[model samples]
Target: MSINPRTIRWGILATGRIAENFATDLALVEGSELVAVGSRRLDAANEFAERFGAARAHGSYEELAADPEVDVIYVATPHSRHLDDVMTCLEGGKHVLCEKPLAMNAADAETMIAEARSRGLFFAEAMWTRTNPNIRRMLQMIRDGVIGTPLQVRAELGYAAEAEKTRMWDPELGASALLDMGIYPLTFAFLLLGEPVSIVAAGVLSDQGIDVNAGATLTYANGAVANIAWNQVAWSDNRGTIAGDAGFVEMTSRFHEPTGFSVTRGDQTETYEEHVIGRGYSHEIIEVADCLREGLTQSALLPQDESLAIMKQLDEILRQLGVTPR
Candidate 1:
């Protein structure tokens, strides 16, 4: 956060596909610079930097964290590594935007948040989907009573994931229908209903001890309920919906991304769509820059408390399904 306001310098902490996509979208934003990239392997770092116009490529994450020019670091590693990776950046005096499911569980997530607070640094879970314009409008519309009282919320994200050793299908790495993919549907539900008063979750676990598919019912104290599903076996509709007494709104497939949504009443239905630049990561990038300029630690749009609540829910769901422990 000590970096000047002239141009926000960004350094990516991984050279994976998400890192590449982020760098590409970051370039689409006007006021940020893709200054550096780092990886365990030096060649991978160099290759990512060369492709993305980064000024420096560090062979090790330690090197990237120690870079004097990097004002912020985006942790794109798997969920299991979030705490360690984020702590590295915060201790190095750089702000962080760690990818979603900020850590494997609530305790680790709170630890990350606490560290950032202790260091007086900005830190956020990179839930980029919440930053989309269409989703923002949807939130406003719901608050305006366009959807009446939310009676039910249902969401699901499913796909046949590629077989990967360390990344996917590994319980130790926190791979599961809920943490890896189901989080989108769960997040969609959480944004609308806040935290659930109680949950009943069940799932099918993989041979590696991860849940391949799962379902949960989140009940709110207000008599609202959300039924959500997640899977890695096959692709579902990838849809999300929130239904109220007056009307209902449903986001199209891949609801987590920048996409259109429709609001339906008893006799009328309205659809919405907006054009997004470069796959929508630009929105969160801009949010980070703005927060930095204003000296804010966390974004109002994506708050720390909400992130912690989501993690706590995920941990509970895992326990219910026996993916972790009861």
Candidate 2:
């Protein structure tokens, strides 16, 4: 495609649920267009394109990547397939937004990032929370001293998913509570506290060697600590808190896609409610479009280096749990 800065043409490289949600939000992004969709099955691709109003449907991923009308491709495949799929897009000269947990491990993530940087193509792990308005608002407040000096972070996310989904327990698919659910809280802590000085982690692993439940305590250089947990065997409160010297900020349950937040200072508490665009996924879409228009290869909101750092943390956490880092 002759790239149009104002309206970036997008191709969806999968027809899964995440791809559907992303396509839904991509429609809401002002300067983005869903031009094509691809799937292993032509029927599935056609169905997705029809539902999403995409102009073309390709039976194979390569065809979608080679689509001259697509300026960028969204690789919505599972993390296990990310390296190959992302490389395919980059090789075909298409910018990419691969879904979160960018790759199964740091080495693969580094490879994907290096490929994109070498090609001068825009690329980002679609960690949609980083672009959420509520998250951004809270980060700004912390920076503005609303919470003073943050000293601790507590976050947890979990659900009983393995019983119903083979993918949730299958090692071949890189399935685990840590990669699927833990990444959010880990990224949350990283956003508030940066890299940690050291980490102590332990978890319960299934017979298949994937984590069923896990917890980690990260100690930072300035005496700050973040305790994060992830579980696939039960339900959790799913809330998060960042406590600082002067006060604290609490995100409502399901913090990853927070509906609102509250701030407290000694004797006072103030609550904030922000409107989220379609499932809060549209913000990342808007962010990617804006970056493309500005001719940038990365989003400042979720930089490539930060993605790599988080992946390394995940790798370490997995190793601590006695599972070979995927």
Candidate 3:
């Protein structure tokens, strides 16, 4: 990386709430600037651009992707549009940091990875939770045997949403509890247990054909198991626990957000906290900048293979629930 903070000129490809949050966080991170923003509507693009102090605003994704000044593009569109948006950025010769679940399925993620590899452009899924300091510390502790032999993991993330409205219940938007809330716990489990050898799922689908709530049991070959659950029809504790032979780790609510976790061993418990710069999204932006400056095609912290594996897990979960990807 550069001696000075690595400045990455960024173009945002959506004007949604999450995109706005990411832009706000990007501004807080040193060596990063939001140079452009794009939306299907000119006014929305201009509005977001003005709000974020972006240098330019484009009415179409192509315009933002084609901007020579933008060293990279952030794909913050809905999950359904991720593949299209990411492919456009890659084809335009811009590195991409796509929001997760990378695409609607593993096949799409593989295609995106192939394109990035062939083009020699950096590509990564924005699983910002993996970049969080507390999570990193927890993972290190586990690897160092502070947790001893992993036993079982359990997690849940959910919130209530109207079945008649909102994207959470919309089948056409690729909306589901699994894709939204479930991905966090599922990814968390995957990080701890790796790819599971078998998966069993049971869920109740909403009237709109989306899986409103689901519970999954992932059995790993190493004798580790993860019990995960997600719901859009009700609230859950939204906590995570990683239990091991010697100790356990627990995360408070919003496990995917700026987090506070505790490690317990015998009668002693140690708490770890992470501070966010703006909205907690800036940490991932910093990783992207460092990778770009170092001429790396993927972040060591959140590699392409990890993204692909998570997508596969999601695909299997969806399949078990009879929700096919578009």
Top candidate by lDDT:
2
lDDT of 3 by residue, 64-112 (tens): 9898889989999889888899999999999999998899889999999
In order of listing, the candidates' clash counts read 0, 1, 0
What C-alpha lDDT do the candidate models reach, one value each? 0.88, 0.93, 0.88
Query: Each prediction's TM-score against the native?
Result: 0.97, 0.98, 0.96
Error of 1 at 92 (Å): 0.2
Q: Local error of candidate 1 at 183, Å?
A: 1.1
Which regions of candidate 2 deviate over 4 angstroms?
Answer: none
Output the number of the TM-score-best candidate. 2
Please list all clashing residue pairs in model 1, or write none if there are none: none
Task: Tell me the lDDT of candidate 1.
Answer: 0.88
lDDT-better candidate, 2 vs 3: 2
Arrange candidates by TM-score, descending.
2, 1, 3
Residue runs of model 1 more than 4 Å from their true location after superposition: 164-166
